[model samples]
Target chain A: MKAGSPIATSSIWPEAPAAPPSGLARSQHKSPGETVAGRSAVTERAGRARTTKRGQPDREPGLKRANFGRGAGLPTLLLLPQVLILVFFFFIPSLRALTQSVLLSDPFGTTVHFVWFDNFKALFASGEYRQSLVTTAWFTVAQNVITLAIAVVLAFATDRVVRARSVYRTLILLPYAIAPAIAGILWAFLFNPVVGPLAHMLHGLGISWDPNRNPNDALWLVIMAASWKHICYDYIFLVVGLLAVPVSLMEAAAVDGAGPVRRFFLIALPMLGPTIFFLAVMNFIYGFFETFAIIDAVTHGGPAGATNILVYKVFVDGFINLDLGSSAAQSVLLMSFALICTLLQFRYFDHKVNYGV
Target chain B: MVERAPILDMICHAILIAGAMLVCVPLYFAFVAGSLTIAEVQKVPLPWLPGDQFLANLQTAWVKADFSRSFLNSIVVALGITAGKIVVSLLSAFAITYFRFRYRMLAFWLIFMSLMLPIEVRIVPTFEAVANAALPLQWLADLLHVADLWKWISGHDVAIALEWNMVNTYPGLILPLIASATATFLFRQFFLTVPDELCEAARLDGASPLRFFWSILLPLSVSNIVALSIILFLFGWNQYLWPLLFTTDKDMATAVIALKNLIPRSDSEPAWNIAMSGALLAMLPPTLVILLLQRWFLKGLVDSSK
Candidate 1:
């Protein structure tokens, strides 16, 4: 259920531990015949003792404690292994990427020279790179719009339906379990020109459906595959958002002579604005990075770079073509862009989003 | 219930059912394709219904494509990455949460920043790092070089260059992918909520920190641990590019990446049904995890975003 609720608190943390504080509180409650002034003094003393015992760190309930205890050696030793792993796998390589972006190395990497910003300049200058950027922007926008629209509709319908609610939920949410690559393969199989069922259906409708030749068709196929996989995620969130809508507002609107559609537009939509914004940023990121698997599986950046999103282009250049410097430069650019999005989300959207439940 | 509109309710139910069915369309095609024979699957209009050749196709996929071996490889790799990530993250989270060490924030932030640079962004340099790490072999080469300083040292003539090329090994497949930050963040948040009195009680009982960690903290954090495990397992299993990059040896291929290899190249007539069967098999572990641990999976996902 509801995040930040007390449901998760019950299982691990004991509500009433067998400690002196609870025992004292119990004794004080039992002896209710004492004078009001004396009882107040005793309670105040207990509160002070409790605070000291709990220690200086947790006094402010909502504030995260910066320090947990006053020890260094053991904690540092405990943290060393993970720190090493992070250094090797994450930090060092990221630093390498950053450095590589500004340097020029031979293909074999035996010789290197400092060519500050040439790689980045070349990346921006290349038409394919610009096209990939355009494609990424288009894909991110199209996928988010389509997924959010359909998911919102589905969530609304699922929320209104009474019978088989859980069944419908289980069915709708199943796609979230499937990997993007697997989702791509499944959709590709469905849209295969010769053997695909959808292709056959389209043929029956007298529409020539060929992704192999047409760039736009290829683009839309990848977009559809990516969007199809993401609908489940947006649907789940929108469902939660819909359930969190205050029932009283809807009822008040209804009593004020508004129909269900009018009430939805007037009351629910405004309240759901934060959730939509949150899902938009999330879906945009998902479309940006995670859809690489879908593109790899379905289109492989397609006939003449039609569905070549930025992430896929990075893969094509780095992994397939082995163009390391350009790939590294592109990686730096992509990381900066994604980092900006993440920073924006945390800075602006995170605090503003209201999880009403 | 707001207006008791019977017609609207019917419409809602209809749309819900229709949407659910639409969501299932690709999966249904995959299932049916996996059931049919290769010939049947390649028919002008692919079969819409399941065929009796399901077992035959599965057997072919499992044996011919070496799905059995790759499936074992996938299990080992996924379990290895999950265990490594969970252990490393848990220890670091434990350190950061329960202790006020010098430079604790530095360590925490270093780990936290890892979340920003996922494999997609730094794939090339990460590949180089993994390739050149040489790990203990580099130490061995150094030790050998030191030994060769003496003229009478044995085996001086032999050149010792070990690349620690973990191209197809379990360690190579797992380690580069296992240094996770989200898990650490999740565990730290959970640990912050834990009542400090419990730690005090444990300390009073003469239990050392490790004992307290093992007996008290570990058990209390079971839900978070399990939720994180399921998520990491799915993440490890679904990996496509990393495994594809690291493993050139066919036997070391994970099931997800290996599924692509099962597909015939464009020039050849493809074994559509067999590839579909492989896809279905590849999907099994994560799908089963999601279905069985749906609540925890959802919770872990939503909570981690927070």
Candidate 2:
């Protein structure tokens, strides 16, 4: 379904006399002939007149305006707890990180000195930091591509099967419930060089598989684990998106002599563009941030830091090495990444109504 | 059928079955490893079948990792976060939707800004804030010179520092993590769909805002609440990085973090059976929640993402 799609008023409030002729509700009841630009001026007076005549005849017309609760005092009081939390936890810490990015402080915080741009400059100067930027880019792209490709295939396949659709869905979605750390652990166990069956099989096939010493193997291990956990999430959204595709379109395509594969590639896949884009943005964020637990569990950014994505480096620098300035700088960079992703998502969501069938 | 493509259908089933199997293999392997003895687990080919040492391995892992304490801590933290988020989000959402207040949109936007600052992005500063929970208040007091005023009035210097460190505590674990923009937005969306007539009728009956909310809105939101709670509980339980960094005390560790402790530090071969058993145990609660409340879980997932 499209974002901000109107909910059916009758289904939610069965006892209500009729739909409340308010702003949002009025917009939901437009006729086919009415233009969206002309809706507000036409519906506003009509809705007020209709509602006043049909219900609440005793109430003053001045009070007929929307929003039943009056004044700001009680509402302000109700909002205090959550606002305080946002201030203390989210706003304060984010601001603190921003300020800390410009200052160098001792581990114990007993001494501090302002070093504006030095942390960022040093980060950009270091080959390891530059390598980490490249590493994070590669990791995010590889994991996202692999996960999305598999999820799209599985979701479309599940839609084609009529016998036990939900059974396959539930089975595939089981991984979403597992913690990323546990997923990493399970995969690590399966690929452990000494005792792992999969590793043994790979060795039997003459592939040298050693995650402990091989940087490429270590990166691949984390990538596989992260993708394994992420596929379920993408599959759920893709399945919903696929289900929303019209069967009539498929039938019409079939009537035109299109094969099932051709019909899917031409019709269903195009209809899923918005959903795929949404999933891509989500997967970008997941790969950037949420896969820290997987990397920590599976590779710990090991084998000479080959798997040290940016988020893991932030943790290692801040916690392990106690380089607060550098880590805060990295946090600032990651915050910008989050902001960019969020902006992209909101922009896409704003245009989704136009994209819908 | 439009085309009755049995061959296509068979191919689809084959793809689905293979995908499902691929998704489930790691978990099945974990189970198999957990059921084996240490030596059997270390075998080159590894026993594909279950051995008789499952309970023994589970007990060893449980005792070694101190899961009894960690699981209790996880339960408390997860429940605290779930309840805290629901209460906070419900109140804020109700206020935003029902009341026409000045700066109401401003407040909503301010909370919305938190979507950009996830725990991962602000790890160090959040940790510092939690370590000294009163830091913000202390800063305010310092800026306003409260301590100086008190010292001048009493002719004695008074240390006005407030130490309410939340590290390794339940509030530390739950409160910082409870300001959820998604949950707030979900409740807001649901609240918007509610007919305005209901609120008008409640107001006409002389019911106050809180009374209307408690008596009318809350009951209607049961399904939404349950769905959101299922999602929030799973989110809280599956938390790893936050708990790993915040809770240094072994007694305060979560079950997910405790799974890390089962990994061997020495050069000696790690105990695969025990670690796998711990991993299985660590994932059980959320897994059961997903399986038992699959409908609500999916509903919450889809709704919150929206």
Candidate 3:
């Protein structure tokens, strides 16, 4: 009934140009005679606005905005099952990990002592943990830089194509679906010294490349493997980013005597700032967490612990060695790092990304 | 596309094709190794071309190693997780979108917080939860003193071991992985984009909420649902760590987990071809899914990230 009425009409017209009711008007805006449904619906849309409460129009600086529902009981009931599951499986376990981080537990988990912050102190003091940190830092840097560079180059190439672009995209992205474990195995097989083709090529080139015995070789191999799967993801995003760049802007730049290379560096690169930032954080997180399977399947964290990333070490300490305290501590640290990245990504990037040209 | 440069276009295709080849090198080796004889694979610099023993290797992996069973196990586990996540998130997304409940943001934040606590970070407690499924129930019983009431009624002492061990079970494999915040978030975003008028129209038609959900919301979100399914299927099918931790029994192992086990542990005379065959088997399902649902899978990835 309220669908086309003046007040209800403005709620649905996402592109309605009327300025949101400011200060005095917000108080007077809710019509006393508005039907219950219309009032609630209007309030829901108003509630989504940045500056105000239920009955006021949102002044958010965007063309698209989500309309939230405003009812009671049934909606709450509908959400309960998922909330229960998440609370049970996710929140409780994470809270347990947080509490466990503060307490020191024995191998069998029978006896526990509340030793607050000692586990964290021990982690900071440990040489192995420190080395893992260094390794993780370097790994994150190398993997993301290489992955982004390759992806940007390839995405630029793919974006330039006027024919069969999807074919190239499909082929490149096939690796994205392959599990990291499988990717690890495949890459490890390629570098397998005995019958591996890449190993044979290295041998033919007189480099004496043996990943099993060489720490640096093992590290680079794992990095390449991890980066291999990720290039597809970054490439897809970059292609999307490149496609989103306005042709008029580039054409205008071209007419201004900018070369193709200059056009890319000056115009396209800056325009893709948000995409690049998003991919950086994602690639870094991927290196930190998701590379565990890759490292496990490929190097098993070593030719002398060379490839043991922080995530792999966490798994080793927790599941393999049963060091609950240290593992829990490591997990807490990992969680903090992830949370920071996620928060930073949202705080600085989301608004910019949404306000796309 | 803005410029017409023939030479640059040739260079671009050349570079892309080369990169594609590099990406496929490992896969090609795996395929070749899967097809070759063990003796041939053992030869220095294994043959790059496919051999005629493909059927033999597949037969060996399937019949002798019981990979077919593991493959079926993976399918069941993947499908189970996908369906459970979809159902759970669908209900929550529906409720959160349509209802104005107290502490609604609290419920939303609680689900959102789970995105940070990935399974890897809380593997230990999660393991304990699954292993001692009755632990929480026991705590509840203790809190509520149900044991006292039971003893008073029965007039005999009873032990509530309630050893609800889920190790090596289908539900165990699926349940822990199903409470995904990402899926819920994606669904909520999609549902939010849906015009509120649809709901109002349904309400005016005297349609019950369930009827509206079944006939209207579900039908409207088919594309989103399909895309999410494709992505979730790959995720479930490709799980390695959880399956490895839980499924100690070879018969209960997922194809990916069992494939890792198939690698010859012995230092002397490894069966490289068999291992390749196992890898090939492990990759087949998800690879086929991605290839077939490439469009939906890509769309889902972009949408979820957004």
Candidate 4:
């Protein structure tokens, strides 16, 4: 189900005690003399009052309250402990972090920094910082393209020949199960100089290697590593998109003398565009912050800090260097970058995408 | 009639198989490295073959790295996080979708926006909170009015009863991610697809909200639950950054932090064998989860809605 047609209003909250389900339905239908809108308002309030009574039957009053919680109520209570935990630990801490970035540390617990642009300036002034931002942007764009392309090829290919389609799916998705740190470490060793098996293999093939020393190598390797590690993530999304396309539509296009390429470009691809676009946004974000694993493990920002992405840089500055202020500044920028892109996508492209049911 | 181009298909299959091999190489390397003797592994050219040292290396990794403890620690942390996340996210999704209470949209948006708030950004305050957090052990001690309370509960069930002392426990790793914005988003989107009549029919049948959800909505949404569970479990099991940053207790939590710890120390003090072992150990749960959950994941896309 994509989106439901609303049958009942959310007049009740997180966990209103449930009233009789029948009472709720009856409440929806007006009696012969009752106006429909007026009936709903009265019944909704009555349902609310009944659910609030909790224990023991206020029969008619309690009945109304029960109706309110039945739809949206239960999930709210189940979600409460977690929502509260998140509000404090996740949401509040993030707020505190956000606040710290803006304010100067004071005896009275962080007075205004007042230099609105200073922290941002410090971030921009550092060549390492600017390099990481640009590097991360390039990484996101490149990685998403390669990952999506490779995923499309693999999913389409499997949709044709594979008898054990699910097995291929599982193998491709194996990387998603591995930790980023583990992947980075594993790949780092694979890309090692003079000794790594891959190095030996590449050398035997007369290909120049060394991801750590060359900046281009570092950037490309990070892209490849991200796509390599995340091919399955995109594959899952694309295949879901693929399954959404009706076989009849493709068969009809085939009967009309369309080639596989023509059918794909004209019908399947357009149909899959929404999933693809959603994935582009997903991949873009992953490339922005989530690539630190491969970056850290493979190159540790590299021989010349070439592989340094923003999140890892934040990690180094905050934890390794213990420069909390600059780190907070960098954090704010990273958050803003992500927030802006997500908001822009939602605002502009959201309505354009047709996620198949 | 099909025009089967043998050469092109062969080339494509070759590349696909090669890609598969390429993906497995690191794990192969790790296995090779982990099974070799230290001296063999550190030799001028590393051994490419599986050696006879698997047992010896495993024993050493277990004894020296406390890998068994780390494995147990990971299990607890992963399970705790997954369970907490499932309960919290389900309820939250349920509430946001069905409830018409005050601030429903606001709560939903707050949960929605949270998907983009990187934990790396929140590290400073999270660390501060962790460091100064009231020790559940100390609080219990205060409750008991005993000075040696930490020591008293160090090895018992009572130790787990303390709240703030979760520093090294599974709760520390699980609590922060108990409520996930991503899961909420997914679940809310899924709930939007359900037919309203079923909910209404159940309501008219006298199903309490909880009763209705447990019976009617939840059973229908099992595929969504399964899909969310697999994703959530993998995320929990593979979690590295938060666990590494937040908890100091190496003895009890997911093994990823411990695996990260085992990264070769220096030129003179390498620990690659144990590190690789730990990495492999950390990988098992997620791999197992994926293998088991694929059917459910695929089912969701296939059944969908009428």
**DockQ top scorer:** 2
DockQ (Cα-based) per candidate? Answer: 0.45, 0.55, 0.43, 0.25
Q: Total backbone clashes of model 1?
A: 0
Candidate 1 C-alpha lDDT tens digits along B1-306: 445878888888888888887888887887898898778888888766899988888888888778888889888988998899888888888897777656877886688677678788888888877887764455665776754654356645654466656677888789888777777766665666577688888777888778888998899888777767887888888888888888888888888888887765578877888888888888888889888877677555555453
- Candidate 4 Cα outliers beyond 4 Å, as residue runs: A2-79, A106-113, A203-216, A344-349, A353-357, B1-12, B43-48, B130-166, B192-198, B269-274, B297-306
**What DockQ does predicted model 3 obtain?**
0.43
| Candidates in descending DockQ order | 2, 1, 3, 4
For residue A138, what is the lDDT in candidate 3?
Answer: 87
Clash pairs, candidate 2, are none
Q: Encode model 1's per-residue lDDT on A1-357: one tens digit a residue.
A: 111222212222223111112111221321111111111111112223334445763443221243345768888888987888788878788887888888887778898889999999998999999999999989899999999998988888876776787688778888777778888888888888888899899999998888877888788888898888889888876665565455666777888899887777777777667667767888888888888888887778988999999988988888778778888999999898778766655543223233232
* Candidate with maximal lDDT: 2
List residue ranges in candidate 3 displaced over 4 A. A1-55, A58-72, A353-357, B143-160, B266-268
Instruction: Give the winner by lDDT: 3 or 4.
Output: 3
Q: Rate the local accuracy (lDDT) of all candidates.
A: 0.73, 0.80, 0.74, 0.62
TM-score of 4: 0.78
CAPRI category for model 2: medium
Question: How would you encode candidate 4's per-residue C-alpha lDDT over B1-306 as one tens digit per residue?
Answer: 243546655654665665567568788888887887766766646776888877777777666667688777777777777677767777776776676665665676677677667666566666655554544344556787564454566633333333444456555667776767755655555554466677788878877777877897778767566655666666677776777676676666456666666667335456566666666767877888767766654433222210
> How many clashes in each structure?
0, 0, 1, 24
User: What are the root-mean-square deviations of the candidates from the true structure over C-alphas?
Assistant: 8.8, 6.7, 8.0, 11.1
TM-score of each: 0.86, 0.90, 0.88, 0.78
